[model samples]
Target: MTTAPGPAYRSAPTTFGAVARHGRAWLPVIGLTALASSAVSLALPSVLGHSVDAIVAGSGYGRWFTIAAVLIGVGVLCSLIDAFAGTACVAGTTAWLRHGLVSQVVRGGAEGSREFDSGDLVSRVSGNASDAAQAGPAAVTTVAATAPPIGSLVLLALIDPWLAVAFFGGVILVVGVLFVFARRTAEISLSYQQTQGRISALLTEAVTGLRTIASAGTTTREERRILGFLPELHRHGLETWKVLARSGAQAAIVGPLVLVAVLAVGGLQLVDGRITPGELFAASQYAVLGAGLGSLTGVIGEIARARAGIQRAAEVFAIDKVAHGLLPLPPGPGRLTFDGVTVVADDAVLLENIHLELPGGATIAVVGPSGAGKSVLASLAARLRDPSIGQVLLDGVPLPALNHHALRTAVGCAFERPTLVGTTVGDAISHDAIGPVRTLAAARATHAHDFVRRLPDGYFTPLPKAPMSGGERQRLGLARAWPASRLLVLDDATSSLDTATELQISKTLTEDRYRRTRLIVTHRTATAARADLVVWLDGGRVRGVGSHQDLWQDASYREVFG
Candidate 1:
């Protein structure tokens, strides 16, 4: 029975959960570095305020200047440590995440899925994963570094509540405004990423079909179609920047207003003789610290955009419905039997209730009209697609129960339109797999060796600069499929060959030289005439099965032949 296609990726834990699990080992070192840096930074401003108080009191500069210098040195040391730790964390996490995503894709068979678009998958794996990997560690570290400043704000609150209240209120307002803008930026960023994937897919398609474009004289039109999507991408980029600029301006305005309010309130208390100038200096320092923290809202905006990217990337790893089943096969010569099998594609049944059996080492020819599903039935027997209903048996075992690799090895097929994976003649002949000896022999059996041996490098000659003739490629395709062991399927394989060459290949296949179970899908009556049995198919069902002369004398068969 037919089964639906599988998902591109498995359902894994969330990206954050994965990061947290992997990054937990480094947390102690990162936390310690952040704490040291914040302590040193906070001490610098307090030391500066103390020095200013000493100067106003006319105290000697000797001790205070030395204290300030020591505090600066400590701040520099902590800054170095912070830099080292941040770089280490980012590098390590990026490497881990990239490797993880690649492994996930490989395990999921993402490349093999019909739902997986190659260019889109490439964009997700390379561009989106890189962005997310780089941002994840830095974002986490920034939040860690912000913790000490938050604690310092609380201490400043105890020192002077009015200044603290004004600073904290302003910070809350700035954060709220930035968050709203950040959400908008994130949405636009996601749209931009999706557009980038589409642009990549279009460019890939254009390159792949360059020959068709040139032959049709439509290169300019294709180029225009490719560039059409660029404007929308550009517009999204500008909108993201506009949100960032507006948020920056709001933060810039709020910083000064909070500082002014703190100064006015603290200055009045100092004038009233209720507080010392040193305390006022310290209060102003706290206001500056709060403003500095408020500015981090912009960094938060960047993190927000990155988080949206990560979420989109996570989708590839969230697909868990893919089908995977292992089938076993018994050892013997390959024989195929289709029992009440039907094949469906694109909402239409292409083959219906086909019951046929072929014994080992037998030759059977399948013939029908252009859309009579002969090729579709052959594909089912070869296991390229499963039957929609009923069973397809290889040997005594069902197709689904046979080991997929062994079944394919025992039952090889040469398609009506074969695809070559390499550039050279020899490479195409052996599918770039067999040794030189086997490759040449197969080419000779299919009569492709003569044309190939005359070329500049003999069998090593590369394919033509332009598209080669259909017949030349088809001969190479037959040569590639000639080395199979048990069952050989030719689906209009000789359609592009000349009459003489087709007759020679047909003689070689039908003769007792090769003991193989052969299934030939063709329209040529001459080819069918040579077969031991002919199966006639019409409108998705088999109408007659007999020898060629027997079918020729039948009236319905006569109408089809006519």
Candidate 2:
């Protein structure tokens, strides 16, 4: 199967549209509420203009008082509506964005697509998604809020076109300034976010390898490397703020200047009888409304940043590829075959032109020197990685064609470095399908049962909260895997165990009681001695395949053994 494309190439709308469809009901509600709120806010200035006109006309005191009271009431009502709508929009968008991001991460899978970087994926899912969540509601609300001011501008133009022209002109200038600065702000913000992700990944790697760093006396140097990224992050933040600050100053200074200019021109018009006092007052109020609209420049900047975040999030959701096998295997007790298979990675052939067959209820040992690709060969048989050429089959069917989950269920692997789950030893082995057999059974097989039983809670004991020795962890890892999979693959799994323990486990696995195919990848001559067949690999090719004694008699095999 072809590998999936990376996150960068996928269409953003596919992801955004999916989120919107899922959140349609709430999104519309937020938009409608915001529209209503903006309408109410727009009414306030109109009502105030009416009240001022009434006072100027020498209307009854009670009439002017009533208009003022109505304006105040409308202002209060709009504030409440704005608060409620803002809260709903923010809460709904946050929930949707978080949910969508999580779904994307899950579907992307743990092994990840070859094209996507794990560090970048982490940052997009965790940090960029958060930024989108925080910004979505405000951005939606701002767009909604723009509508009423636009409508009011139309109404103002009908009242007096010259004043309307001034309002539009001022808005254009402010918007132009905002757009220019917004681009710079967005670029810097994206850089900062990407850098932060890289820093986090570096820290995670350092922490996970703390022992190695400490042992090598390289902790200080590693720390300094991490610290070095901070200056770059700081510089990006500073640059973004500088651009934003300059844009904000321009908006602040220009908005009031436009308002003052409009007011002065309107006053001159009123004196010249081109309009009434009430008309001039209304026009000035409209100018202020336009100024309020201009303030959305700051909101526009926020939106630019949010758009960058959305793009980042979109990149993560784009990765649709995962490693998969190209063929299927027929169902039966696990019978494995390697048909002229070769494995290559990083332009180096690790396993080449190897042919082998492992029948059900049989044990085979794969013997090779280090870097001979014995483990790589075993992993291919289990379909961990596809063969560079040729095919591996299970039960007469190609391995890749088997359903991935089913294939994994049929095959279990115990790595050279074992991995255990859960804290308590009993917790680790309690539910293993092999039996309710205590941790001791598994530990004893690998000679870990004794040391574990001596701990405070014995089989019920928990591992230390801190890190443990590699060998101890590996033993526990094997104990966990041994009982879980039907077709067991032990890739140097017993390397940590003493010779006696390794022999015991090997003997137990060889018995009819196990009744499973076992592929042991090891360097131990004793392990090969116990196998029904020994496949010797050398320089990525099959050097020999036969009983250990048969290979021992061959000149090539004897030379290596000697």
Candidate 3:
């Protein structure tokens, strides 16, 4: 089931704004530290100029000594503050962004509209989030960098208007260069990020499919395909370097010219007795300050790259989370109902006019031919996905109306090929179980306890070291899902098991304590025949609903299993 996405839930789009919103607790530290650092930086040159005047005057040594002490003290303080603030901001922002990205992806579910490959999603969570984390420090550093230029301009004007004029002219040219650099770098950086994501996707695909590739004797072909993305990545990277080089060269050229201009003008003023020797020294220092500040073009470049990364991360946040209603379901039997439900994807109608009203504690087998919507219907029943056009209800309450905990606890699912997540077999089976006894009981019911106990450490053995076949893995998945409160969905979950084991498992499910609404999707005639009722689906529509014997009377139905 799919629909146009709802409103996006996210912080601000701009990197700085996002950091500010997410890491507000650290903002005070960042702002205060940057201000102190910039103030100390601006004071150093003026104090040095004063010390030079004192030296030439043969004034008391105490003045120079105090200046040196002050300089050391402020420099130490500034460095400490900068270190603390930058580190805190980066760590905080990274945690915040990763939490938001992971939450969005997980809540969206397997059948939801927001989908990304494992590699691309990993890139966003790790690489892109790391890049976005720099927003906090970049903003602070830009503030610190601006202080020197503004202070120099004011001091230069005070010393001689002509000196200030010459410095400002060069600054204008540098600013222009940086503006162009930022724009060009932004484009290249986005392309670079996208290409990197593509390469990661290709590599991840190749690794996951390594066995298939090796068996098919196409390892070299897969390798070539993965490598093909490198040239595009290299080209984008080169474009970024070109922009940086042009900006660096222009800044370097302008820096020296500005220094010379300031020195020449100050020397003439000194010769004319328009300014003292100390004043001329101060003018030279101001020129260096102005040029040094222009180095913040480097920061601007970082901001551009950070913006590109943050933009990619923002795309992850923009994916709408699954919509849930406020109403909660009352505890009772899982009477499943689908009212005029429809499922569509990419403009193709997969299921149409699905209407079902099944009683609680019944084993309802959903049997269908290939291309039928059996799996889709099972997904709707478990609320793994919602219907596009109508509602799926549990005990007359819409699935979305139940809170996540209520819904998840009430309806559990097992898939044919399950990807379990845990180091030990015990952890994998009881990852979300209510008690260890319940976990053990579920495992025994699914016929996994015998094999699990045969392993070296019983259930404590690590899953990776304890080898198992496909059928064993499927049994474990079924055991893990055996604790559902009201409903259990098995979407061809036992397809790998032998007929005897599958029948035993099915018999266990129908026992007294295990009685619940069961929606089993299967192709086997025996499995369907055992169900209390069978829902026969064909070509995305419900063809019949009755006992397995009644449905078997139709030749087309018998042909499904044949």
Candidate 4:
């Protein structure tokens, strides 16, 4: 049997590779601008050394002021270029990552609940995407910061080779310490991000089930459960800080020692007349600029955090999307057939060897025990999921062979509790409507129009602001599904509606002008009795398929309702 995909982030490249792949067009621009800024910055120290020599040599004040003006102008231009480059890189990468993440989530092979909770998924999609977007800019900034130290070292070598070698050794030691610290930070940061996601998931679950918890008098218990993850999150935070502190202490000690050593060497060279006074001054300044800034360590820390975030974001995209073919479904009547269908996971079979044929424009009622797989069959019929071991065909063409647009246009589904996602009732139903009149007709068919008309602004009322009961929401969901012209799958969608409303809606569905291929999952015997055919399921196997009256003669079938 087909299995779920592997770990979400497995076999993915590193954050740097991902940024290079998606932000290739923008990265070159960022790099060029950053290099320009570095050039301006590198000029500063050399210009200062030249100015010092000019003063000692009694050079005219006019040339000194002219050099100062050039320095100021270059600084301003560097700042503007860096700012614009950073903004553009961030904007471009953010959009690219967000689009990729959302597409993966929407097209995931299984429902999101099977892999990640809503809150965890939300954090990975939004927060992780933002962090991943920073990778390109952070890399550019790190490159720019690197220039001053390397340029300073090159200048020091020209003054005295011995001094440059000694300072380079110390810088290497500091870099080694930073490397160790960065690795530790990445581990701790990943843990911290996961813990925060768990906490968010807990809080979301608690809020969504607040009524159940409150009614059961378990408020304190639920609160305690939500707070339990805080200590673990705090521990991870403290570990990260400790690593940073150790690295900072090592750099702090190394920086001053390297500076002192360079000063001493330069002083000796000056006494020996091996280097001039201005050269000694420049050499001392370069030593401090090269080692004292510790810019590399700071930038490395940022890069480590971004790597952790990008890894999390990559996990989302690594989930395998549901595979479908490119063929367009042919226009035909709504005839569905399941040949040798089977669904199994982890040695447990949820459906097995199911074969059934559904006629065009006929209503079928599926009745089964709680675990008999009624909902699973409905999902297969509409290609909400592809079967593991069989072909589900629509009008003699396999459902998976049909393009996505054709599949959606040919089939619609309404659930017991629909997630309404629009600002107004009209907007929600209009998403699936052929036109305005069809939209209104759908609402009326499901008896949702009467209550919608009573809302504060009729169909224009904001859904979030409008109060709705369970039955009303079901009606609205039905209205949204009502526009399907070829097929409709209602999986317990009417369980909340009263008898009178449910009967009227059923009548409308059965009318010749409004009828389609209707697959209804229900436990109500009366509902099944009204269908053209009934498929009775027992323990993942189809026990019988016939008219409801024919099946009513069996005592085992009658026990399904109880």
Candidate 5:
């Protein structure tokens, strides 16, 4: 399911300085290359002015012309280096941010990360992350960009103090225009990104439920609703260009005034013989370099976008990660206990005051009507989510107190809709802590070995090339979970299978020699009947806990299966 961004979406603030700091070793490369580019730019004007003087004097001018050409070549080479370094820096930082975001989301787990929509998280990771990586390179390059203008001012002053004074006036106005642009673009870009994320979320939700929409004949309504934010996105996009255009207009008016002022002042100095023709030409070149602030509008805009990206990424970073203790689990059968466990979301209690204990090495079926918190109890049994009010313990050790490896190695879970992620069908079952040793046995146990062997390459077949029905995928999920030695939780994991396959799999679960605790959340009366004990739940409270036959004697308990 997808959700719209609410007021608490961006609760944490991300700073530009913080983002730039992430560049680490890459920052120095970008800075050095950009400074080299600036140095070459500053040297070129002087070399060209000297070449003009040598030509006018009718002396040998080849040396000066060659020097000017070399300077230009050096400038181009430095620019190329700067570009390459900037690209590498952005690439590295994007990977870093993506890794951090993904790790954070995974650490939070499904229940903890429920506040975010899948599409929105995708947009942030792929799109906003790239934009955020620009912070380091953009900051370094923008700073280096200042060198040329400042160098021009110094050169203009040496040519004639009046030219420096004239260029400085335009610099002031250029700075003002840039300041306004940076501030305005930051606000508008953030809004644009938010709207874009919203559209992505709605589109993802629609795609996920595409079949429902088609069957209900509501595709038109869905399309309209998904695109509802387009107008707002369009308006924000237009404003970004409007801001750029307005700044360019201001620069156009102010830029020429500075160049004209320098030339006008330098011409008088030349007429008075206070400065040479070459010096006046040099002054004009300096004026052009110093007043070319309009050219940097694009760079400034990128910096603004980077800021917005950092802010958006901070939202994910702010999510509280599931923390585990350093202690390991001790040897015992998976004796599970729920002490006054409760789970509440948005003031609605899903599970309330669940205080019960299930002995080790028992196959227990958690049976209840829909919304009776059956799945919730199963999740608690596996410690996938911590109880809001009380702690869940395994073998008398609090689940949260155990370290990550200790807990994960002990429990395995299979879900109704399992996503098999690996390069090959065999690889997915062998993925995670399950390992390859049990892959074959687990497959055979779940009755998936035959269909898997029929594939073109058998276990070696790639996941994309190996097509599977819903039940087949579920069996693979069970195979993946089979390596657990302490507890196994099947949350409607076999629901897609036919009754015969389901019955066969159920027998394997009960009669297996491993003797580990098995918690099965199922709606089928057959599954409950096969369990050593049935945890009959109604309205989130335990109605009874005993043999299935004993609970079946109650008419209300029979209606739960109905």
Candidate 6:
């Protein structure tokens, strides 16, 4: 779901504490309600104890009973308030976290987010964000949930010193149970979520390539590959249950000890006439309250899960998006210049320091062998990515210095495997907000108009119902990119078209009716021959920069087309 950036508090937080503050506005309400619930719980025992004393003494106990009933109602009311406040806090914070994450993904764009798999990104944005958003409520609730036990300790001491002393030992055991559980669960939860993300990433990849898998008769194999991590996931799930079972067993055995101890000590006190029957009853209730620490297991588990999610989201936040400058483009022809550019990834050079300058309104063909970095060069022309060691200037301004709107509007790029995003065929072809005239012109120029008019609903047909072949989709992509005012970088964007259609499209592109610079990455020799200039690249560096006829004299250059 796309949303505008929220208030300043909605920015990505690098730590769990920062994530908790996303619910800061709701924290006080949650805390007050929780404390109110705890107070009602603590007060009820004394009221009931007093009523018991009055009944035993054969006096009026109606007032105390009424106060006890009122306390129960107040407790229920506080509980309802806590439930609503906690839910709102979690949901609001989740949305905030999600908004920040999705914004970052958009800001980072493809190049900045290339390190993350699409499926993995979906998992991070959907499940992980929700989990992380629980930090605020979980932290507050976990602390608030401890109040009853702590309050019981103080009240037990007030009633009789021996009762408090007896129950104190049990509280220590409860603390140990919580500590061990938190530590064990935290590690496992992180691993579990990471495994889930991996599986999600695999499933996403499979979906994108489902047609290939089916054609290759590897659907069963793809399914097996996608589910390969199930064993590990199952192990993690089993481990989590085991940890919960152990914690439960510990609580079941140890939680009652505090109550039994309090009762035993209070019994002795009662026998010696040191504590009244009412006081003993009150002390027993306090003991039960103190023993309730075991229930915090659920809250602690939530905190652990929240922490793991926070960590995952924080990693995404750590990746810096490519920064764009605010300067608008100065008026000039679309002369593109790459000054000593080099691109390296994973310790391997994709493009070595290469220098080239192409004049505006020229059709430049970049031809290369399989790994000769033709696509990378085209990407630079469109500013899809920045060079690792140099700068690309459109006209006179560095591409990074131009305002984003200016940069995007001036340079349009189309890829061979273009992903159509809009709902209808018209929407897809005109996604860049070009006017009807330009949109129709682009469609006609690229021959997409012919097929589009034949669709069942013409341009209004839904993309899923359009049933376009690869070449038709390429034409639509070219149409989508045709509105550029300055430069159009076609990265093998017409490879799927038949030779006849490719020729017509090439004629339009080379004629430069739009008066924009065209950088075409192509494997076809005819397309290269049509260009005003040819860039022959070998390995990651340019071997020659000349016209196609001149470059054709080289045997190695001829081999590039082969």
State which candidate has the highest TM-score.
6
Greater lDDT among 2 and 4 belongs to 4
What lDDT score goes with residue 70 in model 1? 86
Better candidate by TM-score, 5 or 6 = 6
How far residue 250's Cα lies from its native spot in candidate 5, in Å, is 1.9
Give me the overall lDDT of model 6: 0.87
* Per-prediction TM-score: 0.79, 0.84, 0.94, 0.93, 0.92, 0.96
Model 1: CA > 4 A from native: 1-16, 19-40, 51-112, 272-286, 293-328, 340-346, 364-367, 416-419, 422-484, 489-494, 497-508, 511-514, 523-527, 531-539, 544-562
Pick by lDDT: which candidate is best? 6
- Clashing pairs for model 2 are 4-321, 327-400, 327-401, 328-401, 328-402, 443-449
Local accuracy of candidate 2 as per-residue lDDT tens digits, 152-236: 5786777677777777778777667767876787788788887887887787778778989999999889999878899999998
Over 4 Å off, model 4: 1-15, 24-26, 60-65, 109-113
* Alpha-carbon local distance difference test for all models: 0.73, 0.69, 0.81, 0.79, 0.87, 0.87
- Order the candidate numbers by lDDT, best to worst: 6, 5, 3, 4, 1, 2
lDDT by residue for model 6 (1-562), tens: 1111111122345588998987987999998988898899889888888988999998979999889888989889988998999899999989988888888877776766788898988999899988888888888888887888888889888888889999999989988998999999999999999999999999999999988998999998998998999999999999998998999889877888888998999999999998889989999998888788888888888898999999999878765566677888887779998788888888999998889999889999999999999998988788777777888889978887887789888999999999998999989988667767877888998899989999999888999999989999999999999888899999999999998999999999998776899999999999999999998888999999999999898999999988
**Candidate 1 C-alpha error for residue 305, in Å:** 4.6
**Residue pairs that clash (backbone atoms under 3 angstroms), model 1:** 6-322, 7-322, 327-402, 327-403, 328-401, 328-402
Model 5 stretches with alpha carbons more than 4 Å out: 1-14, 60-63, 433-437
How high a TM-score does candidate 4 get? 0.93
Clashing pairs in 4: none
Q: By descending TM-score, how would the candidates be arranged?
A: 6, 3, 4, 5, 2, 1
lDDT of 5: 0.87
Per-residue lDDT tens digits of candidate 5, residues 1-562? 1111111122234578887888888789888888887887788888788878888998968998888888788878877887888888899889988998898788777865798898899899999999999999988878988998999998888877888898898899998998998899999999998898999999999998998999999999998999989999999999999999999999888888888998899889889999888788888888888878777888988998998999889888888677777778888988988888888778888888888899889999999999999999998888777777787889988887888888888999999999898899998788664555578888898888979999999888999999899999999999888888899999999999999999999999999789889999999999999999999888888889999999999999999989
Query: In angstroms, how far off is 321's CA in candidate 6?
Result: 1.1
